[model samples]
Target: MTKMIFLNLPVKDLATATAFYEAIGCVKNEQFSNENASSMVWSETITFQLLQHGYYQTFTTKPTADAHATSGMLIALSRDSREEVDAMVEAAARSGGQADVREPQDLGFMYLRSFADPDGHDFEPAYMDMGSVG
Candidate 1:
């Protein structure tokens, strides 16, 4: 079996978070989703599990970090081109997500833009041109 990644995140509102992800091109996997949690498919090998804060706490004893209060983690997704990266940022803003979390970065062969979901989880959409790399 191929190894897959499941990134679990705590959310204040499952529906809103799920919708935010959907609006930005992720598809929900109903097979692994429920009222308190959603399995958002980012790629064939990557699934992001958005769990309601209380539901998420059941998974571990550690306190759930308040993403809005402090930096938790940054989730980066790859795009096909620089335009795609910019488009995703636009989509995120239209879907009630916030951009300007960090300044957009362009490094000739790579481009990145950051946004925060309604729950304040950071996501960076990036594009890289391997052909342009020296």
Candidate 2:
């Protein structure tokens, strides 16, 4: 069986979070979504489970971190080309997300840019040219 990843994120509002994910090209899997959560599919093997803060707390004993003020993890997504990375960031910014949370990086073979969703979950969209790598 192929391995898959499900990233669970605590969100402030389900509707806004769902819209933001959709704007960035994720398809919502309504079969797995409800009032308290949204199952956003980024690709065949990756899905983001956006859970409302109250509902999310039930999953763990620890308090949910205020992502806007605290950093927990940074998710990096691979894009096919540099333009694709830029497009995703642009889409994110237009969809109520903050673009360029960190400075863009270019190292010839690889290019990366970062953004934060409305809830402040940081994501880095990157593209790497394998042929250009030493």
lDDT of 1 by residue, 63-124 (tens): 99988889967989999998899999998999989986889999999999999999888999
Q: lDDT of each structure?
A: 0.92, 0.98
TM-score of each: 0.96, 0.98
- The per-residue C-alpha lDDT of model 2 at residue 19 equals 99
lDDT of 1 at 39: 99
Q: Which number leads on lDDT?
A: 2
Candidate 1 Cα lDDT to native: 0.92
Q: Cα RMSDs of all predictions?
A: 0.9, 0.6
What TM-score quantifies how close candidate 2 is to the native fold?
0.98
Looking at model 1, report the run of 10 residues with the lowest lDDT sum: 66-75
Q: Which ten residues in a row have the lowest lDDT in candidate 2?
A: 125-134
- Tens-place lDDT digits, model 2, residues 1-134: 99999999999989999999999999999999999999999999999999999999999999999999999999999999999999999999999999999999999999999999999999999999999999
